[model samples]
Target: MFTFLMMLLLFVPIGITVDLAEKVGKMLENDVPFGEIAFYYLDFTVYFANLLFPLFLFLSVIWFTSKLANNTEIVAFLSSGVSFSRFLRPYMIGASIVAGFALFLGMYLAPIASQGFNEFKFKYLKKNKSVQQTKDVYQQINDHDYIYVSNFIPKTKSGLNFTYEHFEGNELKYKIFADRISYVEKDSAYKLTTYLKRSFDNGIETVEKETQKTVQFPFELEDLTPVEYAAETKSYGELLDFIAAEKRRGSPNIGRYEVVKLKKWSLPVSIFILTIIAVAVSSIKRRGGMGVNLAFGIAIAMIYVFFDKVFGVMAEQSNFPAIVAVWFPNVIFGILAIYLLQNAKR
Candidate 1:
């Protein structure tokens, strides 16, 4: 409960500061209402809550454990025939709870909140929003087929430098290049209209007859949607489908999504491991004191982050299994925690 209050306290002000600073900067040259700026600030801050949560959990653990050690409660438990592992059981439980909360917020609440925040930015912050918008741009229209728009305006569903490619296995089958493409709203649906098409056949190029609508392909142009911003934006159910769909398509960036999905579970597990490790590291009353405990804890945390990031990058570029890549750091540290627990008990 106390930890939650601390998180709330830190989250609100930081959010406001960020929002107001941007608003003030924007307003110095333009006239925007104070109330609107305040609303934007609130929205910005709320969206950042997820990013702030991990630090909150880490600091809370450190502060709480430091107090426990300062009071010699942890030392007394170890001296009373209580194994360090047994003593750390509650800390593990607490970490699990925090991790659960983090997962819930990250997977569910954050996505919904992010939509509002992004909309606010697009509507208020962006100038010429249509020209700047980019979503549903370059998309895989079908297997072995791709559509790319050099720039797309999502609001108008218009694109410039449109290029479409069809591939047979690894060989290029047909390529169509267009100067511009636009979507026409028909009744309740939309139709894509192209202004130009250059088709390549038998290693020869010909300008296909230009028309607003043409059945020149095996796949429909409208079938593609933008790649999702990130897995975190999708619900847990959506994330599963997204990953499966991408994997089936032989998408390269799926490693990032895989890591994200695993992270939902792994983040919770990490809390438990770190709690055990912290208890083991701090169980002995060291001459260097809680400062030593903190330094060691921070060092371990930094090493964990470093390796996690490195593996994440490697996984992106290589054929490293996403599940293994994401969880390897945790597994290594978990073993370290167990070993330290045994040593500390003696």
Candidate 2:
């Protein structure tokens, strides 16, 4: 526990420092206050630190436990007739406890903190002001109707030269065109502001609608809640619900969000897997004292991290299913852990 706490405190501050320096450097380019950037960095780094806690836990357990073994304590224990597998029971128990807490934090608390941190960043330090290169944007406000924007600016909640279509299955119902569109937040409901509208019947026929005001009615704007903004929301129930809702509306972004949701649960399992591997690798003492074993453990952990990023990118980009992509690295390492464990037991 002392080792775990020490590593946690040390690494978290290092993470915070690195993030703050990066944020401050970026803010300097925009002439924003270094303190403001530092705050944002701190917020994000806290969330990141929590996510990395499992790695720290695994490292501490291996480092300290291996040092104990190297000092002849494990030798004495073995001489006392304790089987090697039996000797691992306590360490396994501790690993299981850490795994449980890791799951809890990943699936529940982390998402809330992620939401808060993202919101703070968006409000204060967002570098981009507009949506980039959208070929088509579609939204269905009600039954049998949808709106499409060729280009959109999320900063202004506005789209340029938009078109709205109404359809009943395969039949063309009605359509509308606007020079520009925007959304305004109000106490009760959101207002969609459009400069002009041209109504169409039978797909091709168009009729102009004269309006005194610039805004349009019956258009639903997006919810501004953090739950709406964050893809990192915890709670399997909530994620499932959100995925169902988005799928019904035919949203593409929902796929990646679901991927992240599933990954949260899978990531905690790496703690257990790494624990097994570390124990296996560190059991046999080498001439370099504990340092060689420690170096191998860290190297293996780094390889796992690299594998993780590779798969994460594949999940994001290629046609590979995100669920499969995210879990592939874990699957590989789990096999490696099992092999190492068996070999070490001999």
Highest TM-score, which number? 2
**lDDT of candidates 1 onward, in order:** 0.67, 0.69
Off by over 4 Å in 2: 25-42, 129-135, 140-143, 184-219, 223-229, 233-235
Which digits, one per residue and each the tens of the lDDT, describe model 2 over residues 169-235? 8676666666666665554332334434454555576655643235444554452111334467456
Per-residue alpha-carbon lDDT of candidate 1 for residues 133-180, written as tens digits (9 for 90 to 100)? 264355565578877767766656666777778788877866776666
TM-scores, all candidates, are: 0.72, 0.82
lDDT of 1: 0.67
Model 1 C-alpha RMSD to native: 5.1
Q: Which whole-number lDDT from 0 to 100 does residue 152 have in model 1?
A: 68
Runs in model 1 deviating more than 4 A are 1-24, 27-48, 51-54, 121-138, 142-157, 160-177, 185-208, 211-230, 246-252, 313-321
Q: Give the lowest summed-lDDT range of ten residues in model 2.
A: 221-230
TM-score of 1: 0.72
